[model samples]
Target: MCSDFEPLGKSSLFTILDACKASTRKSLQGINYFAAEAGEAFDGIRKMIEDKVALHNDSARLIENLKRARFYLKSDYKVHVARSSNIADHCCVYALSDPEKRDFAQDCDHEHNESCAECSNLTRTLNEIERLLEETEEDEELLHRTLKKFRSYREAIEAWKAHLLRSINQDLCRENLLDKLSNDEIYLNLDWAMKFLPIKSREPQSEFFGKRGI
Candidate 1:
């Protein structure tokens, strides 16, 4: 099975999480008897801790906003048919987000036979979903299962967004770029690109995803 962690492109939440863990661990390990008095000696460690907190808070806030927006990939979507109703509705795949928001599935088959690898993989995924439905004893259980899977999907989306935002922010960080924006608030907002970026900048960032679809 493919691993869920770090599945998206570079500089995603996994890096932030790893940095936070390492910083916390190093802080504990580097504790010194003179730390209370050794101000400069503790400065680097203190900055690391503060950086971790800022990164974590930024990532977490963006994730929460995305969950509220029902933002997710097309592949992460699914349709569940009820026993009483023949029609199935597609659902948004982000964890704890509204399930009613959905996109129709895109087809990829043409001349593939049943034995084809892609076809087989698709069949297995569908079968597993069916199995999960069969095992679900209550309506609440079904929703719980979907939310759990969607949480993973959300992380993947966040990772891709982070990667795209970093590319955009690289240019935005130049001193002249802030002058072009003409506002300190907008300049500061670029620090957390996805969450606080202005609409004019956000257009290109979103278009990045529109073209790549990842």
Candidate 2:
């Protein structure tokens, strides 16, 4: 599988694997992370593969092989994906500005600021859906499922955007409070870690099936 991907650059490999994962309703949180040019280079390849699979007598075998490839390759591929997604040299205007009002820029030289948006998951997911929609143009069931998954992600992002706006509003309120504070009186702020780990133990047999993480 690695040899098959060797001829394609890292970005094309990234797109193929991500597109497969997207079809499975996986979150495209880390993709094209180390790719020099993470453009849609392998789109034609995907279409060709889909066509061959359609015309092949053993279509199930081809699809099964693809499923296995995705499962096995992802663990190895994630290192590059994580690196590429996490490291954005530019001030990710994506992260610094309002999510709703953010503009996609070609060249941004501003100093990098930490932002969840810099991960570029949402952007990639949006693009993947467009491709998925095109690829599944003839398959109504697949199209419906793809749209369903997209709507779920869209709802989640919308909620996060609303939360971010409220946080900005709170920050403005805090600034006004700070302006009114006296020299003797100080405003105290408390920070807490809100991160959690997903832990599972002694799970039932039914838990092993359907929409599970690899």
Candidate 3:
């Protein structure tokens, strides 16, 4: 008895093609936006655009592979639904024969398997495109935050440097007082006077005494 399995439908092939077109369009749109906004965060946006472009290229290649597969199925496998209904009628009969072959044949039905595979590919590609787009947006936000932090740090360092300069000048006043003291006066209270003078905290190496500039 001829199997009663249905051949792949034209609708299934068209659906895959449509999905490919949609995926390509979405990726292209994302890439274009990323490129246009490159100046916003040049490195981040450029990387995102490159990722999207790569994904688009991959999807295009997959579509070409599917097209080749379809051609082979139609020409070699005699699986064209429109040209010969025998493929479908045979599948239907086979489905009623041995239970294992019935299940296997059903699983291999081109319409079902091909459509499922195409849909899966489309979903995966769409998700990747969206993720890359989001990364660009997040990177821009990070750059803005970093700039604000840098400006705040710069202002704080300037203020700290000014305070340090004033403290160094105060040491000069102490030096003048020491010069004025007679030998007897200096000897009379040398330990007490030494305690009052501001001593340098180690030798000045860099700004903030070799500590963090901020």
Candidate 4:
């Protein structure tokens, strides 16, 4: 009833990205309401308002990107890792072995010299994919850390707002910049994990235990 070679999953990347765009646009509307009333008189207040708006926008954007990437890492990139690892990697392993005795699947044409385009392409593709995945791993870690900081800073921001509201001058238009966040109480340590990674087999290592040994 179904085809043998089906796509791994539906392409929901565009749908997720569209939702991100819509939400980001809606959030920016908050900044428009607080535009400086008297131009130069309340520049500091305006700057603070814009900064708060920017933080919200930037945080939302980073979270959306992470979300989208996480989806791809689970779906599309997972498929890519599965497919790219099959024939080419087997051929590569064969090639690295004895040139004369080595054998690969007949269709796996890694027998060509390094100058061959097909050979070069397959070689570079795996390397580049691993490199890119490593970088993505680092980036995702940083994004997670930023999210934690935003959570911790929420309390500081709320306290700052409450204190400022009680001041004789509640208008922000006249301020230059809000004070830097000093409260670093909330700390989060995230366990790092790679959402997109090669599905390497443990069989090779497991075979060692099967051998006759003490």
Name the best candidate (by lDDT). Answer: 2
lDDT of 3 by residue, 34-147 (tens): 222322232332243454544455545544543443343224322222211233322323222356565443343343222233323433433453454444445677546544
Q: In the order shown, what is each candidate's alpha-carbon RMSD?
A: 23.3, 18.0, 38.8, 29.9
Candidate 2 global lDDT = 0.43
Give me the runs in candidate 4 sitting further than 4 Å from their true place: 1-54, 82-214
Total residue pair clashes for candidate 4? 7
lDDT of candidate model 1 versus the reference: 0.34
Residue pairs clashing, model 2: 33-84, 33-85, 34-84
Write model 2 residue lDDT over 61-136, tens digit each, in one string. Answer: 4344434433322332222222122334222233345545435433344433443432354345345445645564
Where in model 3 is the C-alpha error above 4 Å?
1-144, 187-214
Best by TM-score: 2
Q: Which portions of model 1 miss their true places by more than 4 Å? A: 1-138, 174-214
Using lDDT as the measure, what is the rank order of every candidate, best first? 2, 3, 1, 4
Each model's lDDT: 0.34, 0.43, 0.38, 0.34
Worst 10 residues of 4 by lDDT: 29-38
Q: lDDT tens digits, residues 63-127, model 4?
A: 34334433432244323321112433222333234445535222343343224333234234323
**lDDT for position 143 in model 1:** 55
